[model samples]
Target: MKKNKIPYLLLMIVHLGLFVVTIIKKKDKKPLLLYYSGIGMAYVFEYVVLNIFRGYRYYPKVLKRNRLDSVFGAIVSQALIVPVSAIFITFFQLGWGWKIFFTLLYSGIEQLFIHLKVFKNRWWKTIYTLISLPFYFWLVSKWSIYLDQKPKKWIGYLTLFFTFWVNYLNINFVLVAFLKRIIFKKGWSLRKYYVNFIIAPIYGFIQSIIGVIVTLKNKKLIGLGLLHLVDQLFYRLKLIKMKKWSVYCFLPIHIVLLLVGSIFKQQMLHLMSESECSQRETKKIQSPI
Candidate 1:
């Protein structure tokens, strides 16, 4: 076995042991959905930062040149690491001191991974991990408590928004850029501009409103829409240049993400309703009937 692989293998083993203990000992089932929600959100964040944004790389590369390796790696991290960490942080009822201790310990382990060449940082930094750990723990802790009381539709909405954003960034930015450069024999040009920057955002705005009709609909699309709009605006303002083919490339990718987002939104709603029903039924059964 490669030396770098040793750390990941050991971590996976420890994570599996922790999960087994959690299943055997955990009494409260309320946090289950919250755990899943955290995992989903974390996956989206990692996809955007590491895969789309090219913030870092895993040494030896998970799955070795497979295009889907990033997705696989994200799932693995969430499955083997995120849930266990969240569960322990929530379960232990640790004080601030212990929380800090665990945060530092986690950061230290990450540093060890860096030293072992398990991860190579580009735009990523250890301090960022140190800062984010506590926030993640606190977020999961609150989520566990909140889900026990009411079903928050906003959580589902946010998840959908992030999901769409992740797909949009990766497909439009990474995949398209790579294909255009290699296969099309195209170089980044100054004269071309992206039409999806205008069209998709408008489409997303209209679809998100007509479909969801929620207050957050506008809020969700605005930032993404503006990001796209601003890209075009930069070209118009002569602040940046783009290739003409860039617009064509962006259109289909945006269309795909929009379609996927629409389908995903419906599925999320159905799942949320079903979960809510199951929780209510459990409550009734446990009530003084």
Candidate 2:
């Protein structure tokens, strides 16, 4: 409960409050998937602008001296708050007018944060946020609609990828950022946390992506072996510190990521099939002579 954290804490409360309300209102629909998707999508966007390009800085004061503190702040804004807001709008199907209002709302909050000194405006412009968020929210709305309907295969792929990305990022964050279980310093800039938290998760999912392709080709063993080899490569390069972690622990998790991805992909596809059946039933009823 540091004084500086109040801003982020308050924002988290407000955003999460809205999220809970949406959950209670639409609990049967299992809106959690869309929420996870929003976070995953935001992570990619944040990775590019915040981690890779250093577009901004955050000072949440949670980690205090470490760069992870700034990233924690970014996580609060990008991963938690923004995604929940996106879900709120999407679930409610807020109109274009509401979308414009939210665009302004987030833009205002950005400047307000800059003024409050919790956020740093580096290479990022509020104007960019102003321009990007409408499209972002619109895209998320389409994500919800796609999953609601007879979703296309590629949409299912992207949704599952993003969903799996959220899971992998959170678990890896707990192990690396919070618990300090292992370190990934091999090819990154001096063993930076971003290397593992951001880049490594993408590396992990690429394995899963390949797993999907290989499974389709009936080469599941090749996929599993590739996972093993990648894990070993990370360990052999001394990229990972084995004091509190090891390949024994990590390899299975990598395999599990692929499994979870595969399972969810099937679930979404089944949802599409169910939607198709429902639509056909309605059409049949309406076509009576």
Candidate 3:
């Protein structure tokens, strides 16, 4: 189905609005208010930019990263970048050209973490955040005088492109890996590959919202609720824990990857569809028991 645009746009506006509110009230200690808000806002923005706007491909696959560590890691990572990105974009008035360039550069630097095993090494994970930078700014820009008048219409397309890859990475990668960690901690005995590879995607989709809920209540069940029986198992097995405000890794890899991927996604999709159709007519696939 063709992607829906309105919900995505509305979500983006909401996220940017919240982000703005946080910036305005940066001086105030809101007691985990921003962190909780960021979780819902981030998911919405990430979903909208990568899934709703752009039609790039993201498989429903996840990696093997511990939920506890990834959550903390995300917090540490974002804390470092937020000030820098915010300062550059706002005080320095970095335009799209600079934004795009810095986004790619920063992403390449972060990708090192993936390779170094500081985080899971998924191909899409490394680039999608950079790709979203343009989209995020375009949303923010529309509310302010941040863009050139001639490029008005173009911003929507660009925002959409960035949104696709961002969703791909967040859904297809980051969220699943975190869920794997949580599952294992709960002592739900299972093969690692199945946990990280098969069950992870299904759980990842569920946990994406859980991560959002983690904000309202720092406990795992609060966000996702008691859907799975193993809730207490993970709750009991905590080697590490994050205080609700940590998971903000806003690096803008989406904008960078979107620019590159948009050029290729359509062609790739076309080729894949043709290849699949060619084999479908000859094959009556067996159902798995």
- TM-score per candidate, in order? 0.53, 0.87, 0.32
Candidates ranked by TM-score, best first? 2, 1, 3
> Looking at model 3, which ten-residue stretch has the lowest summed lDDT?
55-64
Q: What is the lDDT of residue 228 in candidate 2?
A: 76
Clashes of each: 3, 0, 25
Q: Which structure among the candidates has the greatest TM-score?
A: 2
Local accuracy of candidate 3 as per-residue lDDT tens digits, 62-99: 22234333433333333224323433353335677877
Q: Per-residue lDDT of 93-170 in model 1, one digit per residue for the tens? A: 665676677679878877877787776678888898788878877887776554444557676665555455434433
lDDT of 2 by residue, 76-108 (tens): 887878888888888887899988998998899
Error of 3 at 262 (Å): 42
Residue 162 in candidate 2, Cα distance off native in Å: 1.5
Model 2 TM-score (2 dp): 0.87
lDDT of 1: 0.55
Alpha carbon lDDT of residue 64, candidate 3? 28
Model 3 regions more than 4 Å off: 1-40, 43-65, 78-84, 123-127, 143-289
